[model samples]
Target: MSEPNRFLALFDQVVDQTIAFAELVDRAGYAAVPVDTPALFLGTRVDKIAIGALVRHLLLAEAHWFEQVRDVSPGGVIPFPSNAAALEGIPDGAPLLETYRRSYAERRSQLEALTEADLTKEIVFAGRRYTVIGFLWTVLGHHSFHLGQIDLLMRQQGIEPPEYMEWPEDQRVLG
Candidate 1:
């Protein structure tokens, strides 16, 4: 019921939803599509990178966001490299899954160590200061936004998203 515990609970819910979304994406099956094709976005398609790459970027970005919150370096950015020959640097299939797993582990560990007092403290990143609680909420929102996009993409590909996935349950009590 304390502030920090509440924040941690919210964080856990967000991560659970993210994992569900990822599982849905995995079940949808990645098909060979041209990298230049439009990606699914809220029932519409927009010119963007392939779905696989987008998923990879989402996973990497989530990890990076967590790293920033924990005041650690996330190493190199994982966006698509411009050089066609550089694709080899990104492991395909299973290795990509491994990277995500490792990042999740680190994030969870950091989350476990957070205290309520920590939530109110301001942290500076890239010259911008944000309360720990605010940063955590931002990461959650980012993941939810991307998951919405993934759902649309799956529908476009004629794949049905998992039926069990739903919006994160609201825990607030109404007076």
Candidate 2:
């Protein structure tokens, strides 16, 4: 396979891992836990922001990275409750899942359009330059890093994280 195809395949794998992690969080239930500080996990505090807000933030952040590298603007932030009181208005169930699905689709589409040359080309953002491939890897790494935090929060709440479904033995890339 060509280099771009390989990168795209890896990107898809990362997205799958992210979705799996999100599923764990969703299944763990969204209960209003006591908040001693502003940030709960990874500096994302539960003060004025609803848990849904954090979920949306993560989804939007991923989308933003993809859109930026693709040279397109995915306008507008997804509206979510800003506080515990607002949780009543935020649907804890299907709506959030739908939003995540849509965001994933957008990311996948943006990734599909990338060529090998596109991946290697340097893109400037926030006064810094990164190869498109570097940015994509960063996106994946960022998600993986936060997913661990979310998993930890779930465990702290006495919720077990979902079992990581097994890929084929031959397909296991990590030792």
Candidate 3:
């Protein structure tokens, strides 16, 4: 396959992984994670961002990138919440999930339009300029990184995360 097609395929794979992991997280009930400051796992020094805040950040990032793909400033249809401070004014559970679904659809459409030539497009992210491909890889990396955090937090809270489920033809049941 051509390089662009390869990356596109990889991006689709990551999106599928995101969907699977997100389903598992929802099934494990992310709503159960406490929003309070003193409620982290016993003596754990790494609860810098509350669980609710983390979820908000994830939602915000997904929407932001979706808009960015269109060369548009992020926010018109939805108000952009503060990346870290969204925890203070937590968004509702079902609404946030709906927003996430919409953003995922937007992202898929944007990515579907990607071309090899577009890979050379430059964008600034985290104070550095990167090609579109690099920026997308970074986005996938960021999301996956937090997925790990959410899984760990779930375990610490006595919730077991679901095993990774790769797509296959025979598996007909949804988890």
Residue-by-residue lDDT tens digits, candidate 2, 72-152: 322222222233342245465456657667877877887888866667777765555668877677666766665665566
Pairs that collide, model 2: 38-45, 39-45, 48-82
Q: In model 2, where is the ten-residue run with the lowest total lDDT?
A: 73-82
Q: How do the predictions measure up, each by TM-score?
A: 0.61, 0.66, 0.63
Candidate 1 lDDT by residue in tens digits, 1-175: 7655565566565555545555555532543343333333322112244445555655666666665555532232223223333233655455555666676778777876766566666765545566877767766676667666666666766667665334366556311
In model 2, the number of clashes is 3
- Number of the top TM-score candidate: 2
Residue 20, candidate 2: Cα error in Å is 3.5
**What do the candidate models score in CA lDDT, each in turn?**
0.55, 0.56, 0.56
In candidate 2, stretches whose alpha carbon ends up further than 4 angstroms from where it belongs are 24-28, 31-35, 39-51, 72-90, 163-175
Question: Which residue pairs does candidate 1 place in steric collision?
Answer: none
lDDT of 2 at 51: 39
